[model samples]
Target: MGSKRRSLAAKPNKEPKLSRTDAPAGLSPLDWQRGLRRQFGREQAFGLENLGSEPFFSEFRVSNPVSKSSYRVAIRGRGPGGNFCSCPDYATSELGTCKHIEFTIGRLEKKRGAKTAFARGYQPAFSELYLRNDGKRRLHFRAGTDCPAELREAAAGLFDLEQDGLLPEERFGELERFMAVASKSGHEFRAYDDALDFVAGRRDADRRAALLGQVFPSGAADPKLLAVLKAPLYPYQAEGALFAVKAGRALIGDDMGLGKTIQAIAATEILARHFGVSKVLVVCPTSLKYQWQSEIMRFTGRHDENAVRVINGGRAQRQKDYALTDFCKITNYEKLKPDLDLIAAWAPDLVIVDEAQRVKNWNTIAARALKRVDSPYAIVLTGTPLENKLEELISIVQFVDQHRLGPTWKLLHEHQVKDEAGRVTGYTGLEKIGQTLAPVMVRRRKSEVLRQLPSRTDQNLLVPMTEMQSLHHQENADAVAKIVQRWRKTRFLSDKDQRRLTCALQNMRMSCNSTYLLDQESDHGVKADELAALFEDLFADSEAKAVVFSQWTRTHDIIIRRLDKLGLGYVSFHGGIPSDKRPALVERFRDDPGCRVFLSTDAGSTGLNLQHASTLVNMDLPWNPAILEQRIARIHRMG
Candidate 1:
C-alpha cells in the first residue's frame, strides 16, 4: 500500500502541456500552470461532484484519490473568510483555500469558460496597492510582491495576508496605523471609488477631532457659545453639545429625559454661530413638530414668527412653505415621503431628527425619505437608539453617517449569532462596535452623569389614540364645539347645555385614556399601549420602579390589565381600595423588590414618600396644575 501511494504521487511529477486556450481568461499559461502546481495535481487526481448548479454552483464534493476520503466544499463567495471546506487544512490554515477547494474551482472555471478574479488569483501591479470590496461585500487590500517593505510590515499584524495576496478588512485602529505609515512612506495608496467612503469617514473623523479641540478647549462648550443660548446647560449637556458640533453628523443617545432636545438645540446654535449654518431642518413626530419649533425659539430666543416655519397643510401648501427659506423648517416624519423632493430642494444646512428611533426600520418609507434629504450635518436624537435589535441601532446610525458601520451584510456576519435555523440568536463584538461608533455617537447613561443631572426631569409624551378612541373623541369634540357655538349665538348657556358640555368634556377625556374607560367594553386606546411600552423599558432594570396616576379609577383598571399582561407586580392605590389599606400598598411598592409599579389615583398622589420610584406616568392630564404637580411630586420629591 505504501509503494502504491508513492507510485500514485510520483505519477503527478511530470508536467502536462496545454495551450493558452486551455487556460482561464486573464490567466497566463505560466500562471495557470503555477496555480495547478500549487494544487499538486489535485484537479486531475481528485473526483469532483457538483452538488447544486443554480446561482453559481456554490456547492461541491471532492473525493481524495489516495485516501478515498470525501469533503464538502461550500463556495461562499470570494474573500478571506468566504469559502469553506470540511477539511482539516481548510479549517486551520487561514488561507481561505484548500486542495479540495482548488480542485472544485478549477472544475467550475473550465465549465464556465472563464475564471473569476478570485479563481485566477488576485495580484495587483508590483508597485500598486489599493482597497476594494469583494463579492462578499467585504473590503480587502491587494498588494503586489514589490510593494514597499515598510507598507507590508505595517500591515503585518493588522491584515491577514492570504494566499492570493488579498488582505481582508479588520479593525479600524490598525488600519489607521497602516495608512499613516503609508502616508509617511510617500507611497500612493488607492481605494476603489465606491469604497472611498471609509477613507473619507476617517478623514472627517480627524477633522472633527481637531475641531473638537478648537471648539471645546476646556472639554466643554465655551461660555461665549453658552451665553448665546437662552438656558444654561448642565456640565454633561455642554459636553454633549460640544461632541455633536464636533462630530458634524452625530447621534445623541442620552437616556430619556436627559434633555436630548436641548443638547441638539445647543449644538445647532453652536453650528449657526461658528460653522456658517443658517438653515436647519427638524424632523420629528407629528405631535412634536410644534414642540420642536417652540423649543428652538425658546432656546435660541428668536421668537419671531418667521424665524421657524412648521410645515403643514396639503402638498401644494407645504411646497409653498418649503420655499419660504426660513431660519428653520420643522416637519414630521409622516410628511417626509410626500415632501422629500421639496426638502432636498430646500437643502437645509443642518438636520435634527428628534426621536430618531422612528426610523430604526430602514425599510420604512419615513426612514427612506429622511435618508434622502442629504444635509451637510445631521443630529439623530434617540433616548433608546437600540431598544431591541442591533440592526435598529445600525439603521439610526446610518442616518447620521451611512458608512460608519460598513456594509450591513458584513456587519451582521461579524457580530450576529445565528441559530441552526438561520435566525439571529444574539450578537457578539458589541464593545468593538461601540468603539467603531465612538466618533459619531454620544451616549451618556443617566447613572454615568448623575452629578450633572437635575434633581427632577420632566417630559411630556404625546400618544396617539386608537381608532375607536379617536372616533369617540371626535364625536365628543364636535358636541363641545356645537355647545360653544350655541352659547356664542345666545350669549348664555342653559342648565341642560352646561350639563351637556361637562359630560362631553368628561367623556372626551375618558376616551383619550381608553375606549374601555369610556364604554367599559373595548380595551382599545393608545395610552394603555404607551404605558405598557414605557413599563417595558422602565422595568428592564430590576431596581427600576414607576408611579402611575390617573384621575379616574377606570383608567387604573385599563392600565392594570396591561401590567398584568406583562407579568409585572404592582399595587393599586385608588379611593375604592380604602385609606386603611393605602399604607400597605405604598409600603409594598416601596419595599418589595418584585413590585416595580405603583398605580394610584389622586387619593395616593399627595403625601406619598415614594422616592424609590424613578419614573412617573400620567394616564390623563389633570385639570388643575397643583394636582399635576402633586402627582409628579410623588416620585420627583427629595429622597
Candidate 2:
C-alpha cells in the first residue's frame, strides 16, 4: 500500500526477467523467516511479528521490539542494496554491514512464506559495489553510474594507486575513489575494500610470524605471572591490555577462546599492583559469579583473604558485611541493585565486569547495578562486540567505557547509534560509534590467529528426533494450529481463555524438550519423554565421563537428581556456587580423579579451566553461540 512502482534490476539491463521474486510496484510481500539463531547469534528482538505487513522494497521501517526503535534495513537492489541500513554501523568504513539486516530478511521470509536472497544464500546477494567488476580490478564504478570510459579511467587509477603509496590505509575504500566515497559506517562495501588495501599494505603480512613474534616477544611483561602463567600471552593479549590501560577504559575484545578474560584480569591485577589498590569489585551474571572469583584467585594469587569476595546470591547478610583486601569481590548483578549503597562503603579500589554483554541493555537491572560500581580502575571483558546490532554496542560500551561513547545513553543513541544513510560518507550513528570504539576496543579475531592453533576437527552430532518426541511435538503443534485457525475465524474467545492459551503454548514447548519435572497435574500440554531418557543416559554413563550442560537450571535440577540416583561422582556449577566452594570443587574433580562428570548451565561453565572432563554434551543450546563457546573453551583450549 505504501510503495507503488517497482522494477527488477542488476547492472542496468541485466535485471532478471520480472518474476514473483521481484518486488511488485516497490511493494513486496513479507518473506518467510528462517532461524537466525546462528548469524547474530542472539535472540532477535524483531522476529516475524515485527516484519512490516505491507511489503519490503527500497526503504521500509522495521522496529526493534526491545529498543522500540524503527530500523530501515531493506535488501532491495536499488538504493544501497546490502550496503543499506539507517543505523550507524552502515557508516563506518572499518566495519562492514550490520547484523540487523541479515536478521530482518529471515523474519521477512517467515511472514511471506517466500524465499529471500539472503535466506537462500546471502553472500551472493550482498552488496557487490567494491567487488572487482569481474572480481579482479579491485575497484569498479557501477556499470552505468559512470560512462564506460570514465569507469575505465577510475578502475585504472585504483589499480595504479595500489602499486604506489599515496594513501595511509583504512577499510570501506578502494584505491582512492572508493575511500573518497566509502563511509566507515559498517555493512557497506568501502569498509571491506579499503580495509583490504590498508591491512595488506602493512608489510608482506606474514601473519603467522607476526602473531608468534607478538606472543613470544623479547623483554616484555613477566610470563611467569599468574595470569600469563598457565598459557603464555600472545602478542595481542599484551598489546590489548596495555592499550586499554592507556585509554583508561576500553574493551579487551579478542575472539572467543582468545583469552579476553585473562587479559582483563591481568590488566586489573597490573593496575592494582602498580597503583596499590586494595580491593576489586567484579560484577557478572548471577550464573558466572564463581568464574570471576576463580579467575581472580588463579591469576592474581595475591594470598590475601580479601583478595576475592562474591557479592552475588541471596546472601545479602554476608554480601553486606563482606570485607575487601587486594581480592576480587565477585557478585551476581541482581545483588548490585539493592546493595549499591553498601558497595560504596565496601569500595574495592577496582571494578571489572565479565561477559559484559549481560549489561548490553541499559534498562536492565544488571545495568542499574553495575553502573553504581565506583572504582578508579574498571575493566570490561567481551568477545563479540556487536552481536551484530547497534543497540548492543550502545548498551555494552556505555557499561564498559563511558568516556568513549560519552555520558548519556540518549545522546549516544541519537548522535551515534541511530540508522543513517544518504549522509556525507554513508555511515550511521552506530558506524560512527564503531570507528570511535575501534581505536579503544582491542579486538583480535581468531581468524587472524587460527593458523597458529592446533588443528581442531569439528564434528556435528546430529541426533535423530526421538520416536515419542516426533509424535507428541506434532500433536501439540497441530492442536495449537487449530486454536490459531479458530481464532482467525472467530474473535469470540474470552480474555481468560486467550491468556490460558498463550500460557499453554509456552509450557507445551518447554515441556517437550525436557519432561523430567513435567507436572501431569498442571500441564494441559504435550509431554515428551526423550528429555528424561537423555538425562538417564547422561548420569548413567558410569563407564564414560561426560559433561552435562543445560541452559535452564530448573531442568538441570531434574538432571542432577537423575544423576545422583545413578551414584555417579559428579558436581554442579551455576551462578549459585560460592567463590570458596567453586575452586575446591574443580580441584576435587581434578585431584581425586573420582569426579567423572560436571553439570553446568551457561552461567557456571564459562571462564574456567575445566580440562579434567573429556566428554562434553549440550543438553540444551543457548541462544548465543558465544555462550556455548565460552562453556567449551573451559575444556577445549590451547595451553
Candidate 3:
C-alpha cells in the first residue's frame, strides 16, 4: 500500500495524448526545407506520401540561386496528413511554410487534419494528453480510446519495456503510433497546399450522386413502409432518408421544390410500417400544416374519410388534446410550442418538423416546447439547412437525433467546408449519415424529373407609391425607427411591455403604409383607399372574377364597400368567417360569374384551390417567406 501510494504520488503513468480532444498547439509553419537539409543529405526526395506509413520529413536541397555554399532546404514530413515542404525567408517559418495551405486549403479542409476526421467508423481505446518537446501539449489519436475496460496486461507490457530501456515489440508498436501522429501532423499541413487549388463552387449533380452513393452503403437501409415518395431519388435522397430514420433525428436537406416534404413523410411512413409505429406528428409552418395532412393521406393511400386529422380548430390546447387521441395528427409550429407536452406524450413514432429551419432558434418558445414529449424518431425538413449559419443546422439536427452526428456544434461545423463567399460548398456528415440512413430518407430535386413545369416569371412591377401613401409612409417610417432605437437602448420590460413594443411597431408600420393592408387592423385610412381602388378595378365588369387576399379585417371592410359600390355581389372570407360560411364563399365564387370578387386572407389560402382566376394580387405581402410561397401555391401549384 505504501509503495502504491508513493508511486501514485510520483506521477500517474504519463498518459498518451488523445488526438484533437485537446486543442493542438499553434502549429507555426515549420521550415521543412531548411530543417530537412540539416537532418539529412541533399538526396532525399519530395512528394505527397511515399507509401501509407506516416510521412517523414524529406531531406532535400537546392543550391541557393545566389550563392554556391548556400543551400535552400526542403523539410517535408511523411505522415497521415499530406506533406508540407517549406522554403524559407527572413521570418523563421516564413515563405516555405505553405501559406497556400493556410489560405486556400483551410477553406475545404477540417481542422482535424486529414487522417482522423473520418474516425467515427471505429472507436478509440484511450485518450491521453502529453507535453511535446517544445513544452506544448499534443494529442495522440488511436482507435478505441473510449474503451471502458483498461487493458492492464497491455499497460504492464508497455511498462516493462520502458523499464528495460530496450526496444521491444511493445516499444515498436508505441513508436509506430507516435510516428503516425507526427506524420499526420506534417502531412495534414502539406495536404492544405493542394486543397487551396480547388475553389468551392456548386457541386454538379454527378458529384452529389457519388456522394450519396458513398453515404448509404449497399443493403444498409431498413425502411418501414412503401409509401410513394416523390420520384427520382437521385440515390442521395434515398440514402439521406434512410439515414434520418436510422439516426432517429435528421433533416432532408434538398433545395426547395426538391421534395423534402415527401421524403420526410415517406421516412415516417416507413418507420411506422417497419417498427409497428402507428402514430406520427408533423409540425410545420401554419401554411403547410394542412398540406402535410392532405399529402400524407394521398401518398399512403390512407385517405379514408377520417384517416388523417389536421388540428385547425378550437384553442391550441384543444387541438393538442384532440391530437393526443389521433394517432397521426398534423399541426403547425406556432401551435407546436404550446402543445409540445401533449405531442411528446403521445410518444409519436415519428416527429417531423417541416421547414425545420424555423426552429433554428434554440431558445425560442417553439424550441423550449420540444422538451415535453418523447419521440423515438424525428425528422427535420428544410431545403436550406445550413443557411445563414451552420448553427441553424446544429439546432435542427439536435432536435431530431442528438447523437446521429457528433453531439456538439463544434463537431458539426468542423465537418463543414465553405467557399470564400461562405456558402455551404461541401459537407462531410451529410453523406456519411446518408450511407447509414438511405433506406429511410428519400431526397430528390424536381428539376431532375419535372420537365413540364412552366418557367416561373416574377415580374418586378415597380409601381410608384400613391402621393398620399408616400407621405404617410415617410412619417410612419421615422416613428418606427425611433421606437426601435429606443427599445434597443431602454432595457427591462415585462411580457406585456414586449407585446406593447410589438404592437407599437405594427402601428408604426401600418400608419406609414409599410404593412400589408390585410395586416393593418388598427385602422389605416390609406389602406382602406388602396383596397377600394384595387377591387373597383377587379370588378369593373361582372366577368372580371378575382380573389382579394388581405390579412386586415379593415381592408376586407374597405373591399366590401367598393364591391357594394360597384353593385357587384361578392363574398368575404377570413379566419373570422364562420366555418359554415367558408365553403359558401368558395362555392359562390366558383358558381357565380356575378360574384365578381372573392375577398379573403391567409386563413382562406389553403385546402381551396382557386385556379379559376388568372389574376391573383397580393393586397399585402406576408412577412414570412413561406407564407408568400404557400399563398402562391394555392393558385399556381399543379392541380
Candidate 4:
C-alpha cells in the first residue's frame, strides 16, 4: 500500500524588517547635524536653557521655533539610545532619531570635525517637502539637504513660520521655482501638490462661509420652505446644508441620529432654487424609500402629485415613472440595475445616494450600475464611510468627486504604509486625507452638539442560562466541533455539510433565546422569563414604550408569545411580512399610544420613526456594532 501524504497550504510571504542604520547609513553624525541645521537654524536648537544632568543623562526644554510648542528632550547612554526627543518625529521614525537628537549631539560633541565624518565625494540637492495639518492645523515645510539660505529666508518671509510650520497661504511661485531648479539634480516634491490643494480649499471655505451667511440669513434658502418643515432644523443642520451647496458634489458623513436626511433635503432645495437643478434622483435602501418620500413631503410641503415620486410597481409602471422627467424621483439601490438604462436616460441633475456604504465594494453590480448613470452633482450619505479598509473610502470618494482626489493609485500610495517587499504594513498621512476631505465632506457628532440632544444612559443586564438551555447549547457545540473535525479530515465540506454546520450554529443561537425553540418542551428559558418580568414591571408603573431588536425572527416569535402571555399590547415587523405592509406597522407603532412594545428583527432597524418610544431593548445582539447604532437611531432621531 502507498503511504498517505498530508497536504498543506503555502505560507504567506513575510515582509522585510527595517534596519536601524538604513535611514542615515553612509552619513556620520556631523552630516546629519548639518542637515538639521539647514532645516531648522542653529539659534532655535540652542535658544533653550539646558537643564543640568549627570555625565550619562541630560535634559533640555526645546521650543519649536515655528509652532512655539515646548517639549522636553532626554538623552540616555550612547548612540541610538542617547538620541531621544519627546517630539512625535523622534518616537515615530524607524531611524529612532530626529533633528532634535542631531542638534543635541552636535552640541555635546566638542570636536565636531575631529573625525573624518564628512565624506569628500558627498553631494547635496534641495527638495521641497510639505506636511499638511500635522495635528496643529498648520502646514510644515522642509527645504531639503544643502538648500540655500536665500530660499529658506524667503519661505519664512512669505509665510509665518509657526515653530517649524507654515500657516499663511499666498504666492509661492518664487519658492516653488527655487525648489524645482535646485531639485533638478534629482530630488522629489513631497506632498507639494496636496499642500497647494489644501490652501485653495481653505480659501474656498472662507468664501463659502460668507456666501452662506448671505443666502440663508434666516436658516434655510427660502423661509416659506423652512416654515413647512415638520420641525426647525438645529443650527448645525443649517451649516451642513450650506456646506453641501458649496461642495456641489459631497459626502455627508454625520454620525447616526444627527439628521443627515433633513440636511440632504435642505441642500436639494438649494440646488433647485440656486443652481436651476429641476430633476433630482434619490437612491436609498429599500426600507427607506417611503421614509424619503415622507421626509420630502414634510420638509418641502410638496404633495405626492406635484413634488416627489417614489418609483415602484412592476416593470411597466417603473418604466413610466422613470420616463417622467420633471419632479424629484426616489428609488432603491437594488432597482438601479434593472432600470439602469431608463434611469440614466432620465438624466437627473443631482443624485443623492443614502446608506452610501452599499457601494463600498466597486466590484458589485449595484456599484457598477450606479457608476454608469451620468449626474452632474452627486451626494453620498453614510455614517461609516470606511467600514474596514482605506479602499472603501476611495470607492465612495470616487463616486462623489472623482477628479479632486486624483487617481486611486496615488491616494493609496500617499496613505497606505508599506514594508520593504511592498506589503501594506499599516496606514499614515490621515491628517492629509482629512484636509482633502474638509471641503467636500460634512461630519458632526452627537457629543459636540450635546445641548441640542437629550442625555442617554446605558445599562447591561445579564440573565443566567436555564438548565435546558445549557444542555442544548453544549450538545450543539460538540456536534459542530465534530463536524469541523470531519471537514479537516476530508479537506473539504460539501454543500450538505455547510448547511448542516449553519443549522447547527443557528440551533445554538436559538437555544440562547429559549431551549423550547429547539425541543418544543413545556419548560422555558430564563431569558424569556426575565424579559416577561421586566416589561410587566415597566407597564405596572408608567406608560412606557420600547423598540426591541433581535437578530432572529424565531427570537421575535418567542418574545411575541411572552408579550401575548403578559397581555401587553405589541406590534411586530420582520422579513416574513410583505414590504408594502411595513409602513403601516411603523405608523401604528408610532401613533398608537396603547402599543407598549414593537417586536422586530434587523429589518425594523433602518430609517424608521419610533422616537415616541423612549427606551430600546435588544433581545439578541447583532454581530456588528453599527447595526446596534442603527436600531437606536430609530428611536433617537430629531422630532
Candidate 5:
C-alpha cells in the first residue's frame, strides 16, 4: 500500500489539466468602466486602500454618499485589462473585472502625473474663487464675466451678484449645490477649490464644537447639580447635553425614546450653574409639564420644592410661581399663551420647548407666544419636527436659527420643486437644507444609540372577542364597506354618508372595548375580563406595575369598575382629571407600590412619563400607530 501511494504521488495527474478558465472568468474592460461610472455616481469611488507595489494588490472601501455606509473590494492584477477584483461584479463576470480595478488603474495613472480624462483640456469660466474675511466671511467669484445660468441658479440661495456684492459663507450649502450643478452642467469647479475647502471645514464636527465654545465657555457645568447626581448619564445623553450646551440655542430632534428630557435638564443645569441662569422656563404640552419637573428633580437629585416648580393654578398662584425665580419653572404652552408678557418679564436665561412641533405653525398663538418669551438661549425638542411639510420645519427652526433658514416663502423658493405652470410640485435642494440645519440640529434614532437598552418584548396579545362583539364589528364593517363601494363606483360621498360611515367605525371600535360604551345600560366587555385576568396575573408577581391605556374615557370607566370589583387599588387619569391635579395622581401611582394599575386614556396620558411601571397594556388599538407608540413610551424610557 505504501509503495502504491508513493508511485501514484510520483506520477503526474495528467488525465486532464485544469486551467484558469476552470475558475470563473473575469469582467471585460468595458464592463469594468461601466461599473466604475456606477460607483462614481454613488460617490463610492473616493476611497482608496491597501495600495502596494512589488506584487501589487489593491483594496478599496467605498461609501454610500447619502447613507455613509461602506463596502469593500480587493483587486489583484498589474494594471488595466489584466486586473481582477474580489467584488461580485468581477467574480461573476466571464470576461471582465469590477469598478475597483478601474479605480485602481485611474489612481495609478494619476500617481504617474498623467492628466486624467476630466483634466485634459478642461477650462473653467472662473479663474479663481477667493474667500475674504472682513468681519464677515464672503465668497467672491473672479474672472467670470459669462458665468453659466445653472451655476447662477444653484448659487441663488447664497447671494445675488447684483443685490449683494459677496456670497455669505454661512450659506455654505450653496457650495455643495454649486459642485452638484457644476458636475451635471459640465461646468469646471477646480477654480473654487479654496472656497469649497473653506465651506467643507465649516461642516466638520470640530466647527460645531468651536461654535459651541463661543456660545457656552468651557467648564460651564454647575457643581451643585453635578455633585448630587445619582448616576452618570449614558454616553449619547452626555454628548447630546454637550451639543445642546455648545449650540446655545438649538433643536434636539432626537427620535422619541432617546432621553431628550435628561439632555434638556442637563443643559439647563449647566446654564444655571455657569451662566447665572436662575430662571429656566420649560414650555411643554399640558400633560408633560409634570413630566419635565419630575425629570429635573430625578436627574438633579433635588428633592426640595424650590428645586423645580410646575407653573399652574389660578392667575394669582401663577404670579406667585413666577415670583419664585430661583428655581427652574415648567408650564404648558396654552398657559404661557395668555401670560407671555409675565413670563417674558422674568427673562429666563434658557427656554426649553418639549414636543416643539406643537408650535410648527409660526402664526399660532403658541408659536407667537413662544417667540415673545425672553430667553438668551432656547432648546426646541421634538421627535417629528417636519411632520407634514417643509414649512412646518421652517416654523420650528425659526425659534433657533431664523437667519439661517430665512422667510418661509424664501425657503420654499430655494428648496421646493415647481412645474411648468409655476405651481409647487414637490421639494428639491434637501441636501442644502440638511447643511443649513447641521449647525443647530442634533438627532439620533433609537437604532443608533440603544445598544445597551434592555431588550423590549413587543407582543400582540390576541384577545378573543365575545360573540356579540364580533357580530357588531362585522355589521359595522359591512356598513362602511357599502358606503366605500358606493363612493368607489360614483366617485362621490355625501356628508351624511361620510358621517354615517365614521360613526359606524367608531361604534364598532367602542363595542370592541365594551358594549357598555355603545349602550350605557349594557354592562359587558371582553377586554374588561381580559384586563381582570391580566391584573390578577400581574399582581401575583406582587412587584408588577402596569400602565393601561384605552382610547375612550368610557372604556377607562369600565376598566375602573372591573378593578374596583376585584379590590385592586388603582389610579385613573383621563380628561375628567383637572390639569393641576394630574401631577399628584402620577406621583401617587409611581410611589405607591401597592397601586398595581394606573388607568389612562390617550388624551390624558399624551405627554406624561410613567416609566416607574414595568408593564404597559393597550386595551384597544388607536387609529394612528403613533398614539400607541406614545402610550408605550410612557413606560419604556431610559432609567
Candidate 6:
C-alpha cells in the first residue's frame, strides 16, 4: 500500500491530470498538476490521525515524517477560508490551504466518493447585510438565491425583495424585527452582527456630521445668530455653542479659564433664536449664581435687564422667583432639593449646570435633583469632569444623556480592568468609550485652541464663604459699615475710630481667606479648599506647575499646610525668607521635578522669571490692578 501511494503521488506530476477549468484562476494545467502532486506526496509521506470523536468528526492531527512535528487541522465548513490549520504556511500564504489541510481533504475524499467531496466543498452564496455610505448613509441588504425561505417569508412585506433591498433609515424598527427572525431561524447572513454595530456607530457619526453642518453652514456660524449676540464668539466657542444646541443635551468640559460660561450662554442664545428654547435655567454653585445672571445680561442682546432673575433667599422668595416668566432664571444646586417640585413645574426649556463635577457622584442628592429637573436641553459645564475615576465621568454624563454610555454594569464589565481580588486595577477599551461619548461630550483643552486665546486670559472664581467664615465676615462688614456711616454723617474721624475701621476692614478680608489667617486657630475657609482643589487638578497633569500668590504671608502658611497634607512639593518666597536664599529657592522650583508649586507673597511678585509655570493662582484679590498684573506676569511673560 505504501509503495502504491508513493507511485500515485509521482504519477500526477508526469501526466496532464486535471483540466484547466478544475484549477483555480490564473494557473496552467501542468502547474496545477504539479501542485496537486506535491500535496499528494505530503499526504502519503505524513501520518494522519483523527483528533475528533465520531459525533464531532472534524479535527485531524497531521504529523510531519521528517521533523517529528505535528499540527491540528479543524474542518470548519466547506472549501477555502472555511477550514483552519495550526500551520505557519496556512496563516502566511493567502491561498488559505496548507499540506495539513490537503492531507485532511484527501482522507475525506477517499472516505466519501469524488462527487460527494466536490458537493461538500462547494459553498452557495447567501444573503448579506452591509452599510452603504453614499449620499445618504443607509443599510443595504442583498437577497441571494440561497437565502432561507423562512427569512424571506418573514421579511415579505417588511423589505422590498423585488427592488435593491434598500432599507430606509426610519424603518429601523422593522429592521430589528427582521434581524430577530433571521437570528432565530439560524440563517447565514454575512456581516449580520457587524451590520448592527455599523448602524449604531453610524448613528453617532450622523449626529456629529449634522452638528458640523449646522455649526459651520456655509463654513461659518449663522450670521443671524451672530447678530443677536452682544459679544463676538471665538471660532471654537461658536462651534461649541452649536454643538450643544445640536446635541440637545451635552457636557462642555473645557479646561479652566477657557470660558465655558460664555459657551453655555452662547448655546442658550442659539437655542432661543433658532429652536424656540426660552425659559433658560442656570443651576450653578451659590457663589456663581450672580455671575451667571451677569453673564446672561451681558451677552444676551435679546433679553432685557429685567429678564434674568437670580433665585435666592428663603423658600417663599425662591418659589416666587421660579414663578416668574423671566427669559433666564439662575439658581444654585443647594436649593434644588427644596425647590425640586417647583422647578419641575416651571419646566425650563434649557438647563445649564456650571461646575458640574459637583454632581460627579450620581447617587448624591444634588446630582439626582439636577437629573430630575427634566429639561429638553442640558449644558453641563465642568473644568474637571473626570477628577479621579471612570465612574465620575459616567455619572456626570448620565445627567446629560442617560443612555449615552449604555448600562453601568455593562460599561464597567467591558472597560474596567479588575485584579484577582475583584478590585478595579485600571481600564481598557477607552478609545471605544471615547467614540461613544463623542456625540454628547465636548471637551477642549487650552492647548487645543491656543491660537484663539489671547496673550493673557483672566478668570475670577468666586468661592463661597464657609458657615463660620460667613459669620465672621458679616460681623466685620457690619462694623465697617457702621463706622463708615458715622464718618459720612459727621465728616470727621477720630484716631481711634479710623484705627477701628481699618481693623474691621482688614479682619473681613482675612476672614475671606481662612479663620486661621485671622485668629491663628481655626482652619475652616473656602478659599484654601478651593486652592487645594485647583492644585489637585493642576497636579493631575505632570507638566503642570503654578505660581500661587497671596498678599498675606499668613494665607501662604495655611496653603502650605494643605500642600503638605497633599504631599506636594513647593518653594515659598516671602519677606520672611532671606533675600540671599530667594534665588536658590527659585532655582529649586525651576530645576526640581518634584516642586510643582511656587508659593509666594507679593514680595517675589516682581522681577521673577518663572516661565516654567503654566498656571498662576491668586488666593485673594490685590487692591491694585498693577499688582494683579505683576502676579500674572510672573508666569505669563514671554518665554
Best-to-worst order by TM-score is: 6, 1, 4, 5, 2, 3
| Overall local distance difference test of candidate 3 | 0.50
Residue range 530-611, candidate 1, lDDT tens digits: 6776576556567889888888888888888888998999988877777787888888998999898888889755688788
RMSD per candidate (Å) reads 12.2, 22.9, 22.3, 21.5, 23.4, 16.8
After superposing candidate 5, which stretches have Cα over 4 Å from the reference?
Answer: 1-229, 420-423, 457-639
Residue pairs with backbone overlap in model 1: none
| Model 5 weakest lDDT span, ten residues long | 15-24
| 1 against 3, candidate with superior TM-score | 1
* Worst ten in a row by lDDT for model 1: 127-136
Candidate 4, which segments miss by more than 4 Å at Cα? 1-213, 217-228, 419-422, 455-553, 557-639
Clashes (N, CA, C under 3 Å) per candidate: 0, 53, 56, 6, 7, 0
Task: Please provide, for model 2 over 268-294, each residue's C-alpha lDDT reduced to its tens digit, 9 standing for 90 to 100.
Answer: 755655446567777765545665566
What lDDT tens digits, residue by residue, belong to model 6 across residues 541-612? 777889889988888889888899989999889888877888999999999999999999887655888898
Candidate 6, residue 341: CA error in Å? 1.4
> Residue 40 in model 2: shift from native, Å?
38
Residue 211 in candidate 5, Cα distance off native in Å: 12
- Model 1 stretches with alpha carbons more than 4 Å out: 1-216, 358-361, 408-425, 462-533, 557-569, 579-584, 591-594, 604-607
Considering summed lDDT, which 10 consecutive residues are worst modelled in model 4? 114-123
User: Where does candidate 2 stray beyond 4 Å?
Assistant: 1-231, 312-316, 324-326, 406-432, 452-639
Error of 4 at 348 (Å): 1.2
Runs in model 3 deviating more than 4 A are 1-248, 304-306, 312-320, 407-409, 412-639
Q: Each candidate's TM vs. the true structure?
A: 0.65, 0.39, 0.37, 0.44, 0.43, 0.65
The Cα local distance difference test for each model comes to 0.74, 0.53, 0.50, 0.68, 0.67, 0.75
How high a TM-score does candidate 4 get? 0.44
lDDT of 4 by residue, 305-416 (tens): 7489888889999999888765689888888899988887888988999878756587698986887777767788887766667888877877886544554544665688
Superior candidate under lDDT, 2 versus 5: 5
